[model samples]
Target: MSAPMTPDAALARLRQYGERTSTWSTATYNDGTEKALHGIALTLAAELEQYRALELGTAEGRVSAKCERAEHPVWLRDLDDVRGCPWCELDRVRAELAALPTPPEPQIPTCISCGATGGPLRPTGDRYPSGAQQFVCSTSCTGVTS
Candidate 1:
């Protein structure tokens, strides 16, 4: 098999995927309207969560035959790898998220309930004082304050 990817390298792949999907929302079917990209965005979000978990020591790291293929070697954290692989630094997580490209269209509003910025948009009955459209990213955010 090919060499295993380092945690940062794996994050890079995820970043590329997210950036590419940002452009996918612009694609149209035979109807000629922009395609809905909720699914793709959700998938990216899930992957991001998974990576975050790995970095936090909340999830098991990669299993290797001789532990040589593991990314972010577990032993580097202590004199004898005491705590196992070190938790992913918060800076690395932020950097990974920042590396993703901005979506081609205007960004959707953050979910009032979860504060998530990217997801399916749900219409809010109220509009801005200027009459511009208003929407929340998650449907479950209905009664929450933005």
Candidate 2:
């Protein structure tokens, strides 16, 4: 058997069937032929819809794979539509993430009055050799017992 006709071709055939049926001027309507034409039109319409859905599904699947590799959110939609597409949303998110500024490394103040490092130190409003504010390891390091 020959391969099935494409949806577009089938749709064209359906249109021609419509034109032929419309030209029928007999009082005795060929009910079978008219019904067959309607059936063919509906079949062509359904075929076109299925074809579109397959295409959209393929595109969305590709986007999902890309999202996975990029460690991005995959909001998958099976519908054959472009409105509010998850792939576009994810691309937007990626752009926003790329534009974000990374936080600076925290500066850990060290005691200038004592040899202790990373201890309970407090700033003394004095600049150390590193230009950072001077800190004392403790009150005892500042010569104060309390």
Candidate 3:
């Protein structure tokens, strides 16, 4: 069997057929050929309309391929389509978390004399030599015994 005719080809053929049949006598109108031609023309017209609709839909889809983020291509109708986007939501969450104040770090007690943070430390009762009430890791740090 022959392949089906494309819309363009069918339209061209139909135009040629119309041109040829225009000169036919009124007696020929009673024959089944004109009726069959009329049916084919109606069917072709419907198919052509469907084909044009599909082509227009494809063009619109291509135009709307990119989202507002611009990070990647997405099947969205417009740039303002962030409500349904996972990437946009993630960015919003990250920004919200970043805007929050961070907790302060804990202060570790260190000996003032030797600047020693680790090991056992004892506080000297007398505020002499360094002035401020100081903690010493060992007796060797200051003359005043710990």
Candidate 4:
């Protein structure tokens, strides 16, 4: 486990962001946020799996008497152990999503002649004047938008 961000570092990062005027985009901060969450997601997944397995083993009583494991603890205990409340924090959630299993590639209308397939189609925020997935015409063939 890594140490939590120190107050000084966080304040410095925020101060850096304040210096910028045009757009408040901080690629480094964004990257840090994503990295932190990815670890959290993995940690949560592992914790969840461990809890489930322990539960199943106890239920089945397959765990040997000699092995001797403890009963399932309370939610608060588990949460405390796993550093819970990630759901309440935007940064944690973002990190978790960053590490989440990605959905399968979307089915797209491919250009038959050129055999060009579109990349993962996520929201680009701004609505284009034409309101279409931009495509290009090439020597192989003409392309169209989704």
Lowest lDDT 10-residue stretch of candidate 1: 76-85
Task: Kindly list the per-residue Cα lDDT of model 3 for residues 1-146, writing each as its tens digit.
Answer: 99999868987776666556665556656887676776677677667766665545453443234447777545434334435566666778999998988643224545656666675778767553334455667555433322
lDDT of 1 by residue, 1-146 (tens): 99998867766666565567445544363344423344454476678777676555556543322233446453212223433223355546788988987534323565534555556767667664455556666555444333
Model 1 Cα shift for residue 56 (angstroms): 0.7
lDDT values, one for every candidate: 0.53, 0.60, 0.60, 0.46
* Whole-structure CA lDDT of model 4: 0.46
- Clash totals in order: 2, 0, 0, 1
TM of each candidate vs. truth: 0.22, 0.28, 0.29, 0.23
Which candidate leads the pack in TM-score? Answer: 3
Query: Residue pairs in steric clash, candidate 4?
Result: 37-95
What is the C-alpha lDDT profile of model 4 across 1-146, one tens digit per residue? 98897745654554444444345246744767645544555565556556666655553344412112234232222322444333345556788988987534324534433445553333334432444443323344434344
Model 4, TM vs. native: 0.23
Please provide the root mean square deviation of candidate 1 (C-alpha atoms, Å): 20.9
TM-score of 2: 0.28
Runs of candidate 1 exceeding 4 Å displacement: 1-36, 60-146
